[model samples]
Target: MTTAKTPAAASPDTPQPHPRRWAGLAVLSASLLLVVMDMTVLNVALPQLSADLRPDSVQLLWMVDIYALVVSGLLVTASALADRFGRRLVLLLGFTVFGLASLAVLWANSPAEVIAVRAALGVGGAMIMPSTLSMIRHLFTDPRERATALGIWATMAAFGGALGPIVGGALLEAFSWHAAFLVNVPVMLLAIVAGLFLLPETRNPRPGRWDLPGTVLSIVGMVALVYAIKHFGKDGPTDPQTWVPALVAAVTLSWFARRNLRRPDPMLELRLFRGPAFTAGVVTALAVSIALAATMLLLTQWMQLVQGYGPLETGLRTLPEAVGAAIASPLAPALAHRIGARTVLAGGLALSGLGLLVIWSWPGTLDYWAVAIALGMVGVGLGSLAIASAVIMAGAPPEKSGSAAAIEETSYEIGGALGVAVLGSVAAAFYRTHLTSEELAAEGVTGRAAHVAQESIGGAMDLAHEMGGAGARLAAQAREAFTGSLEWTSVAGGLLMLAAALLVWRLTPKDLDLNEVEH
Candidate 1:
C-alpha cells in the first residue's frame, strides 16, 4: 500500500519507496510499447493510406505530424493533472481514450477524419506518456536500479517504434491500411486490463492549485512554435503565415518562462534547466531524435518506393535497428555506471553520427546490407537516449517527477516534429530542384501529370502507370532524385548529431555519478 503523506511534507532528499515495483515496471513498459508502436506503424502505412484516402500534399503532411503536435502541446497540462489526481488513474483513462480512438479509425474515410482521430489519440498519448515515467521514478528508489529500469523503458520505446514498420507491413500484406490502426485496439485493451490489476495509484498529496494560465500559455506557446517550424520548412521562413506563428511562439514562450520562474509552485518548472546534467540530457534527447526521425522518414520511403519491396519485406528489413537498439539499450546504464555518463553519452552520439555519415556517402544504388549496417549504428547511438531519460528523472526531486517527465517527453515530441519538418523540407527542396520540368516535358509529360510527378516519388510512380514508356523514365528519374535528397539529408543529420555529442561532452560534469545525484 502507498503511504498517504503529502510530497511537500517529505524532505527533498527522501527516496521513493514502493512494493511490487518490477511487476509495475512491466505493466508500464508494456503500455509504452503500444504508444510508441502507434507512431511507427503510421510511417509504413502512409503509402497505402494515401492510395485509399487520396489526400492532397498538405493533408498528407498533416496526417503524419498532427499527432506529435497535439501531444507536445498538451504534455504539460497532462503531467500537472496526473500529479494532482493520480498517475495510474490518468494512465488508465489514457488507455481507454487511445483504444477508442484506434477503433474510430475504422470509420475514417477521409484525411480530415483521420486527422481528427489522430488528434484524439494524441490527447491520450499525452496523458499516458508522462505518467509512465513519473511512476517509474516512484517505483524504483535505488539510483542504479532506476537507471537500469530506465534503460529498459527506453528500450521498449525504441524497439516498439522500430517494430511498428514490421508489424504494419505484415498486416498490410493480409489486410488494408485499416489493420495498422486496428492492431492498436487489442493491444491497448490488453494493456488497460493488465495495468488496472498490476499498476499502483500514486499522486502528490499536497498538490498546488492548478495553474490554469500557465497551462494555457504552455499549450499555445508550444503549439505555435511547432506550427511555425512546420510551416517554415514547408513554405519557407519568409512566408507571412510562418512568421506570424514564429512571433507568437517567441513572445508567449518568453512570457511563460518568466511566469514559471516567478511562481513558488509552477505548473512546469523552468528551474529544472539549471541542472547541468538535466540540460545536457534534454539537449541530447532533442538532437538525437532530430537525426533519427528524419533518417527513418526517408529510409521507409526508400524501402517501399525505390527498392520495390513489399510491406512485409520492408518491415523485416527495418528490424536491424530494433536488434541493435535492444542490444545496446539494456547495457547503457551499466556502461554509464562504470565509465561515467559523459563518455557513454558522447560516444553514443558519435557512433550514431558515424552511421549517418556512412549512409550519406553511399553510392547511387540502394544497398540493403549497407543500410542495415547504418541502422544498427544509429540504434547503438540511440541507446544513450535511455541515459538521457535517467538524467532527467534523477535531477528532479521525487515530488517533481511529473514535471520532469513532461519536460523530457516534450523535448522528444518537439524534436521529432522539428526533424520531420526541417529535414523533410530539405528532401522536398532537393527533389524539386533535381526533378526538372523540362526533363518531364522531353517525354511529352505536361501540365497536371508533370506537376504531380514533381511533388513526390509516390506521385511519380502513380502517374508512371498511365504514361507508357515515358512513365518509366519519370519513375527512374524520381527515384534518383529521391536518393540524392536522402544523401543530403543524411549529411545534415550526421553533422547535427556530432555537434550535439560535443555539446553534451562539455555540459556533463567530469565525475558525475547517477546514484549520488539521485540520493
Candidate 2:
C-alpha cells in the first residue's frame, strides 16, 4: 500500500500537498459523482417519465439526451472559466445551480419543462465536471499521492454511473420519476457547505484574455456535432439532416482547432494531445464512455421490458457491474505501479471489450449468469479508467491542469453522447429490421398495431399488453427482436473498445511509470 515514496525534495516556492487534500478529494469526487450519475439515472427512469409526460418520440428523445448535449456544448467554456476564476468558486456555484435545477423538477409537469430542467442541470454539470480533475491536480503535488487520488476519483465516477440506475429504480418504486431528480438536492446542499469550508481555491495565475470567437466556435461546433450524432442515431446516416450538422461541425471545429493552435493561449489546450500518455488517457476515457453508455441503455431496457423485471429489480441486477467497478477502480493505481500503466490502461480496455464480446456470443441460451459474467468483466476493465485519469491529469503541467481536465471531461461527454445516439441507433435499426411489418401481420398484428410494434420494442410491448388475447405472440417476437438487437449493440461496442485498446496501446509509452511526477 505504501510502495511509492513521497517526493524526495522541493524548493522553497514549491507548493506542498494540501494539508486537507484527502478530505478535499472527497468533496471533489462527491461533486463529480453527482454530475456523472445524472447522465445515466434517466436511463432507468425513462419509461416511467415517458408514461407520465407522454412526449412524442422526438420530445422523448430530447428529454433523455438534452442534458448530455448541453453539457458537452458548455464543458470547454466552463473549464476555461474555472481556470480564470477559482476552481472552488466555480464548483460552489455549480452546486447551487445543480440543486436549483433538480428542485425545478417539482414543477415539471410536462416534457418541455422536464427538458428545460435537464438542460439547466447540464450547465451545472459542465461547470462541476472538469473542476474536480483540475482541483485534484492542484491539491496533490506529489505524483504518488495524485495517482492514488485519481484512483479514488475514477472509482466514484464509474461507481456513480453504474449505481445511477439502481438508485433511480429504487426511487421510482417509492416515488414518482420526479424523485429521481429531487434526490440530488440534499447531496448538492451538503457538498456546497463542505466545499465552502474544506476545499482550497486555485486557478491559473496567468490565464490570458478569453477568446470570444473560439468560445462561439466551440459551443456551436460541439452542439452541432452532438445533434448530428443524435440525428444519425435516430434517423440513420443516409438522411441529409444528419450530414448537414456533421458538415457544420467539421467546418466550425476545424476552425476552432486551427484557432487554438494559432493563439498563444487557446481556449482549450489542444496541445495536450501532443503528449502520448495524455492522448492515450483521453482515448481511453472516450472509448470506455461510448461503450458504457450504449450498454447501460440497452441493458436497462432489456431487463425491464424483455425480462419483465420491475425497475427496482432491474436496478438491483445492475449491481454486479457497479460492485466490480467499485472493487477494481481504486486498486488500479497500485496495480499500475507494479505492472506498468500501459498494461493496466490498455489491458483494462481489452478485458472490457472481451467482456462485451462474451455477452455477444453467450453460449447456448442466454441467462442471468452470462450477463453477470460479462458485466463484471466490463466493470473490472473499467477500473482501468483510474489509470486513464491518472495519466491525463499527471501529463499536464500544473498550470494547464484545467485545460487537461476539460479535454478529459469533454471526451467523456462526447463519447457518452455518441454511444447513446450511435450504438443505440444501430440497435434500433436492427430491432425494426428484425420485427418487420410482415412479421407482425403473420402474428395477427396489423395496421396501427403493426406500425407501433415496428417502431420500438417498448411500444410493441405496451401495445401487445393492450391487445389481450393476440398479445402473447407479439410480445414474444418483440422481446426476441430486442434481445437480438442488444446482442448486436454489445458486439459493436465490444469491437469499438477493442479498437480503442489497440490505439491507446500504441500511444502509451512502453516503459511508463505512473509514480513519476510531471513538472
Residue 494, candidate 1: Cα error in Å is 0.6
Residue 184 displacement in candidate 1 (angstroms): 1.4
Whole-model lDDT, candidate 2? 0.88
lDDT of 2 by residue, 1-519 (tens): 432334465445557877788888889998888777777789899999999889988898888889878988999999999999898999898899999999999999998999999999998998898888899998888777889898989999988888888898899999999999999999999999999888999989989998999999999999999989988888878898799999999999999999999989888989888899999999999999898788778899999998889999988898888988988998899899899899899899999999998878997766777888998999888876678989998789888998899899889878988898888888988999989888888888889878878888889999888988878988998998898888999999999999999999899998888777558
Per-model TM-score versus the true fold:
0.96, 0.97
Best-matching candidate per lDDT: 2
Q: Which candidate achieves the best TM-score against the true structure? A: 2
Candidate 1 lDDT by residue in tens digits, 329-424:
988887898999999888888888989888877766658877898888988888766688898887898778999999999988888878988998
Cα misplacement distance, residue 172 of candidate 2 (Å): 1.0
